[model samples]
Target: MDAMMMDAMSKDMMSMPGMESMDMDAMQACMDACSACEQACTVCSTQMMDCAPACMNCADMCNTMMRSMMRMQGMTPAAMMAMLDACIAMCQVCMDMCMAHADESPVCKMCAQACQACMDACMAMKATMATA
Candidate 1:
């Protein structure tokens, strides 16, 4: 992350009531991964591959997940959990679709990798929430 982003995230984190004690590093990492995945999925989806639907869905879910993190003040724990579930589902769909065409397109392979990483990050966030 850049200094400006870290600073902004720090300010946002400081304002959240109980979020001060949360793992800021993990959250930032997940957000970064989501942003990267969203970009890759968007570009890959434009290729008109069979994975287009899942890629579009993944892009949307990643945007939602990133925006929710950016605006944490609007989220309750239940809402956050629901979002995580949705993101994970989207990632699974995208990954499955991309994997099917991995042999035909390098973009699909890369997109699948991004989706897998995003799924892992979302799962980590979900685990953290469960412990909280």
Candidate 2:
């Protein structure tokens, strides 16, 4: 789903000033990571653990980040960079919180891993934007 969306966005991106050379692969990876993180956090949030609130908040942020990436027409490079930073920060906090109970909760372990992956993907997107 995201691949098709990214493909369509690629055309729009080419016409946008300062985004003509944007890395579609990095964008796709970031979106995919956000989607995965959102799912993981949603499940983890149901675990009724200490990290539930953080997991729920992270899930919301990830969804917002993914949606913003999908609507490239509404995004400037600066705005996108800011969103990525916010996503990364949210994921970091969620990951730290989840990791605290990872040993006792499988859901938390999975959530933490997903958060780490999302953070990495967001960072990669930031680097791609920097080079572009």
The prediction achieving the highest lDDT against the true structure is 2
Question: lDDT per model, in order?
Answer: 0.84, 0.88
Window of ten residues with lowest summed lDDT in model 1: 14-23
Put down candidate 1 lDDT per residue, 1-132, tens digits, no spaces: 555877766565523345444456667777888998999899999999889988998998999898888777777777878898899899999999999999999999999999999989988987876676
Off by over 4 Å in 2: 2-5, 8-10, 13-17
lDDT of 2 by residue, 39-114 (tens): 9999999988889999999999999999887777778888888889999999999999999988999889999999
Q: How many clashes in each candidate?
A: 0, 0
* Candidate 2 Cα deviation (angstroms), residue 53: 0.7
Worst 10 residues of 2 by lDDT: 9-18
Model 2, TM vs. native: 0.92
- 71, model 1: CA deviation in Å? 0.6
